[model samples]
Target: MNPELAVLYAKLDIYGEALQTIKHESGAVCPNFMTCTCPPCRASYGSWALASEAIEKATKLSQSASQPEKPMSVCTKDEPD
Candidate 1:
């Protein structure tokens, strides 16, 4: 229920729904303002890392599911010489 986590989730393309959930839970901007250099900022950075990891995993799963079993190939053995 951290605003920092919500912001990080929002920025992730694959986890936009997660971000929306966060926003619904916490109705406020992230505590770590651009100029913030406090513990909250560090926490936000950590949240961002977690969100990025989720995005990467989701992307891999999506790609794997959509990939074709057989790859396309072209033959040119008898083409122009």
Candidate 2:
């Protein structure tokens, strides 16, 4: 539920899940929650900083990490079935 957890998930390349967690959980505790649409929430990001290492790790994590693939539609042709 912590923003830090989202950060960790982001580092793991699970951005979608990380974001869902952030918006639904951590964002709830924020003063300016705005459904996690805020450029910067009322809460200072520094408050979530556990240490300089966490900040450094988060910074080092690449935004280009591969995201989970979306599920494909399942439609079977009569012949295929």
Candidate 3:
């Protein structure tokens, strides 16, 4: 599957479907392909890394944009999520 398309699907929150598309288009299981040590696999890893970074940046941007601005306050050690 195209790295760009994968990034798009990730942004759209359709990861399982994106992975399926990648498996169909590339004819390789996602994990095996990602970790393969051959030259092509190494290149794919680089491409995938770039796409992942882009997706992360976009997600952060969307989240930050959607949030209301507020002042930060220090929390005590007892605080929890």
Candidate 4:
């Protein structure tokens, strides 16, 4: 995976976790707590969640693709049974 992309994905993951924690601790008095129709809540949980999921999937695919395939091991005729 690209180093920059990896870093950005990691940052997003942290941000998502932080938001979750905040939401859990905050009450309904908080605009973005639980389920709010506020613009910030929509941007943070709606758009940001979608973007984070996309980035996470991309990161996983890139990591899996970059992995080296294992070479098949062959027994040599000279090897003892």
Candidate 5:
């Protein structure tokens, strides 16, 4: 796997975990009853777009990575077999 792809996957995992944690916490409190001005919510909202973009990029990269590559020729036509 490519190093850049590895890094991107790690970042995606981190962001996904964070979003899950935030979702769980947010669900604990009803937003309709109270105006939640929590740091988690703020952070989650702020980074949501970035996380989504990361996921998109990672998905595309993984899809491309899964493709089979053509075998390299050991000798060119000009070279003696």
Candidate 6:
């Protein structure tokens, strides 16, 4: 969903649930990133218009982007053996 809407919803004090509904209904969560592909919410494209445009560009750049890549593993060097 448009992360911005999430913020608005946050300000309204209904971020998790209400914002989610609005985001979906508003077509903010670009279908390309709807199912399981989209980057993390923190990395979201912000507004619906921006997200939609980003999705389109990503699609044109790589047809396979429809299926987002597996998340990169966190650096293991910080962990003790």
CA lDDT of each prediction against the hidden true structure: 0.61, 0.52, 0.67, 0.66, 0.63, 0.54
Candidate 2 whole-model C-alpha lDDT, 0 to 1 = 0.52
Best of the candidates, TM-score: 3
Q: Best lDDT goes to which candidate?
A: 3
Write candidate 5's Cα lDDT for 8-61 as tens digits: 989878876776554344433334323356766555555554555665676799
TM-score of model 5 vs. true structure: 0.37
Total clashing pairs for each candidate: 0, 0, 0, 0, 0, 0
> What is the per-residue lDDT of model 4 for residues 1-81, given as tens digits with 9 covering 90 to 100?
999999999997897676555444433444553378776665556654555566577679889999999899998779678
Q: For residues 1-81, write the lDDT of model 2, one tens digit per residue.
A: 899998887776664445445544553346645445455653533333333335455556644355566799987867654
The parts of candidate 3 lying over 4 Å away from their true place are 1-31, 71-81
For every candidate, C-alpha RMSD to the true structure in Å: 11.2, 13.7, 11.2, 8.8, 9.1, 16.1
Model 5 alpha-carbon miss at residue 70, Å: 4.3
| Candidate 6, 1-81: lDDT as tens digits | 899998876765543344455445554344454443456532443544454555556458667756688898888676677
Mind giving the per-residue lDDT tens digits that candidate 3 earns over 1-81? Answer: 999998987767776446445434543334676778877777766656656666667679999999999988878688678
Work out the TM-score per prediction.
0.43, 0.24, 0.48, 0.39, 0.37, 0.24
Summarize candidate 1's per-residue lDDT along 1-81 as a digit string, tens digits.
799988877666546667444434432235543346566765665565565666568779989999888866979689787
RMSD after Cα superposition, model 1: 11.2
On lDDT, the stronger of 5 and 6 is: 5
Score candidate 4 by lDDT.
0.66
What does the lDDT come to for candidate 6?
Answer: 0.54
